[model samples]
Target chain A: MQELVEVRWHGRGGQGAKTAAQFLAEAALDAGKFIQAFPEYGPERAGAPIRTYTRISEKPINLHCGVVNPGYVVVIDPTLLSPAIVEGLSDQGILVVNTNEPIEAVRKKTNFQKGKVGVVDATQISLDTLGRPMPNMPMLGALLKVVPLVKLEDLYKNIKAKFLKKIGEEKTNANIAGIKKAYEQVRVG
Target chain B: MRKVVAMTGDQAAAEAMRQIEPDVVAAYPITPQTEIVMGFAQFVADGRVQTEMIPVESEHSAMSACVGAAASGARTMTATSANGLALMWEIVYIAASTRLPIVMPVVNRALSGPINIHCDHSDTMGARDSGWLQIYCENNQEVYENVIMAIRIAEHKDIRLPVMVCQDGFITSHAVEGIKLYDDKQVKEFIGAYQLEHSLLDIDKPVTYGPLDLQDFYFEHKRQQAEAIKNSLKAIPEIFAEFKKYFGSAYDFIDTYKLDDAELAIVALSSTAGTTKVVIDELRAQGKNVGLLRPRFFRPFPKEKIVRALSGLKAVAILDRSEAFSGQGGALFAEIRSALLDEPKRPLTVNYIYGLGGRDIDLQQIKSVYADLEKIVKAKKVKDLINYLGVR
Candidate 1:
């Protein structure tokens, strides 16, 4: 495809935005495509966190800057609903927010352009499968359905790079389940 | 040998990076610094420079990846402004202490209190003690030259410290200036092929970098970096000599304009240098012997050089971007005072805070700074109004 596709991932510090990036990078490797994966941070001790992103392409990635204006934005935490974050997302951008609310309900809370919103009970899914509210993996699954740049096999590789051996395999399987479930729930325009 | 082309400071730095052909460049582009990485990526994509540009998500990853690459014996580079610089602050210290010659072009801008994307020294001042060789440039030419010099300085045998070539955000980074571009063959001859040593990527040896320095060794490890910085001061003149020989246009620790027989002087850096120069020249043409001392090298602070130059002068005025929060003085003022402490007769050095938060300081206002210097010279004592000149 000649068109560029970008994914914006929102998460807190220590929330696996970095790990999520690793998963996406590995996934691109799996798909035999080169990838760009990284994070935006602050002093970011424990409580304060930030965003990360991924771009997978059959050709070598040429973009060297941050995802200032993105085609897709993934919010792993509901708390990051700031004016700046909402403002950065493009008009036709797909938003994959990791809250338990249905896409319609969260749409009502914010004045974000309505047509391309994807909401998932990612927190609920994480709590169910991973036994925590860490939506990085689940959010990645949700992102696959929303962000068109990267593929499922790419994400699987991303999971491998992040978790590594045995625990990684289990996490990988769990993430695949999360992605599948999230994929089913999201409504695309 | 002197050719001038108009370009932004960011573009100049990127062009310099293109000449060096670093092995890896990981950057999260923010405003001001965005053009730099973008231009460098162009070089990589065009096959003009065979290098890997790591497309990281944030300034933190950008710097972290630079550390990883430099440790692995790759010549690494990156660029960021304001918020991006702040994000990379934590790792900046590590890059320096690890003694990896990673160079970052810091487009100096104010930190957000009111969400500004304009020029100031706030971002870089915050990074002062990050153990990086901090160099400030007046315009695009210095930004272009310093980036090349930074790699040479950082990779020097006696000094392998990380370097921060600070340029004013919009004033220099985005502002177009007529810069002399060097030929590829000439630049290649200047910045020779990088030789990797004790690198992680060396498969034969397989060495580990960034070992945790415990309480006993921590101070020593830091001392080593400090020593590297100190030694860099000695090595810089030699490198710059070579730079001048190759490039034809020379540089110095400080550029002094007409202070020889002048009674008053204005000491400053960055784009303010241009402002001060015009003001001084105007005052001089009108038979007022006023000079401007623009510090090209900020790290070793050019203390002896400044004292030698300023001691002969009757009075001096210092300008700063940020408030010291210490007294009726700026950070550069305080540093100058500390430097001139041993001098037999220190000049009446007054302090001024101007052009903060992206407020434009035009020629008219810059001339007023010279008037203040004249008043300070007459008073024979340093005035400490802690003045804010630009905006409300």
Candidate 2:
């Protein structure tokens, strides 16, 4: 029974949170760790709130239910930083959010006050590097900075392998650049 | 070398189908189950396998096409969930009664009226008496393996009946997990080639299928079908033994976790069993005598083995994901209680209807169930025989 790290992601339908969870899980698998990733399914509309989950362990994962008390909570949509998003986060949990605001200001605004919080301007990074505001990969960058679930190089390699053929070299490179920027720029409070 | 990859349950089912390369796959897209057929469809479009992929308009037509194809001696498969399974209700029974040996992957979901789409056992439980062999899976790997075993179990010479390998809908179907796959050669060798004793396509031996029968002959035909299902109880383990020899995982009609010498135990199915296992481990660390029995073979109902497992327990809680609405208890509870009715050492049985329509059942709720079982054992009376867990 290896230690299991459970993560829950809060984002909107179009924010690619589900994609980020899947990417992290795949990267964990490539790093020789067992992982489980899945999104909560509903009548998803582009801007509607969406929840996704990921579980990483050295042992094969068998529990197949939603991650109620997650070790980490990743908020992809800044607007979803409400209390409901952190409902079941453990006391030692880390809350990572994609926002341009300072970590202290974001914490005060959301009144989250408890866990170790990590904040990054993923939207700004995505816009600067990828020329679009897709914060999914950048958020993953921020998460990796906080938890180190998989090697940074492994995540980059996974992104390249998955998106190189599907989305072409230019977009892939931009996405990777965004992730690196988020990794470097993230601030923990 | 075995190929180990990360895949969702749906993807694994489709991958298994790709490995099998059945003669026909008639399917319609539905949430959760949609990806399974979609993945197989992609394989067909890419010219990976030579399966005749039939894109049916509805689930009813999907099963109908499978029955037609299977009757013509073609190895057939299909997939559905929730309303899709309900839509194919008539043909579901027909495929089994006609003994078409059609193997289907049923992504277990809640049957809709309020129309919520998530994981539950209602859809498959509704078809419990439909004569198809039902195998519940605890994870994506089991879903993949069960589909492969189902092909062997359903097509066994003595048990030529349809088989449904059921997995929890979004929980297993949409979740990505690491799974080891057999090489194409090993899977092919295990299944061998498909054979039909009597085929509609055989010009030499003319046969009629789905013909109308009145009360006189229908009852006997149904009895024979019943006999085939009973024979499958034996055939399933035989296939499981052969599968373990090749794949190296021992699967049985029932799976037990720390139940050899336990006073309190739980009986559950599918993904819930995985959660229950974790709770059992946590309780065992605290020196609680709690264990679990997961029934893989839900159709023939494994009466004797289940009774034997529970006969010594002081209290046993049966968890049902679907409500039987009998005002008494859930479907599983009813069956287990009846199975232990005449046993001299029958444990005090309780029913828990939980996780209906995809409601989440967490660790606390599971622990609470165990606590209730302990209380029931101590009090020497079942205060509330039926309980609802994790509901408002």
Q: What TM-score, over all chains together, does every model reach?
A: 0.67, 0.98
- Give the TM-score of chain A, superposed on the true chain A, for all candidates in the order listed: 0.83, 0.96
- Best candidate according to lDDT: 2
Clashing pairs in 2: none
Query: For candidate 1, what is the total of clashing residue pairs?
Result: 11
What is candidate 1's DockQ?
A: 0.01
Candidate 1 lDDT tens digits, A1-189: 333455667788877776676466556545555555555534547657577766555654333334567777777888776545665676667777877666666576656755488778777787777776777877777777766446776566555655567576776677667767776776554
Q: Report how far off residue A44 is in candidate 1 (Å).
A: 30
lDDT for each candidate structure: 0.76, 0.91
Predicted complex 2: DockQ: 0.82
Error of 1 at A11 (Å): 41
